[model samples]
Target: MNTSRILRTTNVVLLLMGYQRHWFEKTSHRFRLSLPSVVYIFVLGVVYTACFSQHFDKSSSTLKVLKDISPFLFGLIRVQLALGAKAFAYAIYSSVKSVGAINSLLKALPSRNSQFTQDEASAYLLLTSTFGILFCFAAYIAYEMKFELPPLPDAMLGMALLLPHFILAGSVRLYTVLSWLSRGQLKELKKNAEEELRANLTKDPGNIASAIFTVSTEGLENLKTKLEILEANFCIFAQSLKHSMLFLFAMHANCLLGGFYTLTYYWNTWYVLFEDRKRRIFYAANASIYAFIASDYICLMVVLFMMENERRNFIEAIDLLLAQRKLFSKKLRPIAKDLRGVLKKKCFKFGGPFQPNIIYVSLMVCLQIIIVTLIVTVHYLEDEISLLKEEFSSTDDN
Candidate 1:
């Protein structure tokens, strides 16, 4: 494979796995931790010490104890979540790599017509640059969290986490463009076949039946070749897609837990921070980071929807070919039948069971709404409780 082309056409799912591995190795080089890793460890150690070192009274209320220890809990949960996501990504990478000859088959497909138009290229560039800027903003927030100068290491870690998202977005854009080109080629081939029939009729009027049969045979051959290549590509994609779904699920779970902790346990602190002029920038930065992460997840889901749509298009194209019952040769009929059978048997599924579609997207949106509703409810209840306590104390004084 041409290294540059591979990078350009790289699957985002695989790229994420590679980034995880890269991050791990770079941070733990020679058993010496990177600055970010060191800071993370130190902060975690301090939290642990505070929890166990009798800094708070042993008889404190359960809620008070939990409030003090929530940071530690959040950190532990996030680390485990990161590990789970990495493991899932690795599994997906292995599955994709094990598909023999698929890589070369992908490369063998004609590339002449696959070049992106200017508008398509600009759109992709804009999307990528937008994500890149969002990630940089995230890195800035992460660094500000520690009040550190020369925040290069923290910023790099933030970029590392987002690297997969950037690559995935670019890959999806490229795939869409390539699919468009393929469809255009099929249309052009059909037009050419019509012109060929007209020419043959003018040149040899008596052998019309033979000329038609020959033209039909050639057209079937071309269509069959293209379908075969596409089928192989989809097979590889479907397998990797299954693994990607797993990773996405794991990440979603992590995000849910982290978001819950932030809103439930740290909301007061966040509100106070936002009220301070000097700290308001940090608050906004952190909020933006979370927003971007949420958006990235939604974007990945959208890409999967697009991929599934493309799969349907391939099946429809094959169906259209088969529909011309009188035109296809006996050999061509069997080829089309076999292709349809393969597609029927292999489907892209989530967690090896649920097939995702528009309905899945709807459910995800509803879930987010429910989570936000719960957060708002909690905040309201807390406010009411504090108000009641103040009223009771005022009554006693009177």
Candidate 2:
């Protein structure tokens, strides 16, 4: 699947976009920060900050359909900007330190007996990344046309929107690739163990000692070592993105809330749309924007949950292997024990405090729905009270 080439290309795009300081050296293929790239990222952040101020200013005036929700929308925009900047900063600073770990994984992949088999994983990454970029550009043009902002500031703001998605896709792709590789290694180890057991059983069913003797302790130890290294690397990877992930988690919730609020507002004002054509267009555009952002958030969440399942499978596979060896002998017990210890360590988790699992994600979704309902109810009551007040004032005058 040309995994190395994919990594090389993606890494270069990230570097050029000012998301990362590190770049692969052309001849040596070593990962190190490029001086120019670092400078460019710094400047890019400064410029984005400046453009966002203008964007925020324009948003309040130009966006008039949901006046009450304007403040919340503005806050969402600010959070998006913050998420992007923080993600970029962490990618440049914390993640660059993991270059050595990344290099080790890269080196290990080529030496492995199995070839890359996950073309679907590669395609998923490429498609999501491409769509994210396209969405950002489309958003930039939409905002610039509607707000009549200058090209430079508009483009900068667009890139701000692009950064989080770009960083996230890259992070998930790397993690997925690692998880797949680890699973492949586990498969080979299991197969090796099974073959030894079968060969011994054929000679004599009661010769458990023969099976234990034939089992390569060295190979078991090596697999254990590899898993340990991968787990440590996962820790580093998680810690590196800790702060950034906090922002991203918040960003997702914020997006969902904002999208729901916008949609609900439009739903309530469905009749009002007939009075103003421009307002109708505005409502549709905002709905579409929120929908696009929300879909991306949801898709990413699902992918993470799927990855979580992959992690669970890894632990289960270890248990199955251990169970298979438990009856062998006292000698096999230590090997089983060591693998069990590896299972005890916490593997990589996404979204910082808000770990991606079915329960937590479902709870979060339910909570958002409840919050939106309360907001809509309160807003409706306020409108009814205002209408009653106007009628009472008119009655008194008559």
Q: Pick the candidate with the highest TM-score.
A: 2
User: Could you give candidate 1's per-residue lDDT for residues 1-398 as a string of tens digits?
Assistant: 12223223323322332321111121211111135533543453353334333223445454254456554443634354355435434543533343332333344244342344643443344235435667677566556555545344333333433433333333333333333333333344335433433333324455545644654445545555655565556445445444444454545444554555455545655555344543655455546645654554455455555555554565566677666545544444565565455445444222235444457656765686577567556765776698899999999999
**10: Cα error in model 1, Å:** 3.9
The alpha-carbon deviation from the true structure for residue 397 of candidate 1, after best TM-score superposition, in angstroms, is 12
RMSD of candidate 1 to true structure, Å: 9.3
Report, for every candidate in turn, its global Cα lDDT versus the true structure.
0.45, 0.56
Off by over 4 Å in 1: 1-108, 113-130, 133-215, 260-269, 273-279, 294-298, 301-356, 368-398
Question: What TM-score fits each model?
Answer: 0.55, 0.72
Give the Cα RMSD of candidate 2: 5.2
lDDT of 2: 0.56
Candidate 2 — number of clashing residue pairs? 0
Best by lDDT: 2
Clashes of each: 0, 0
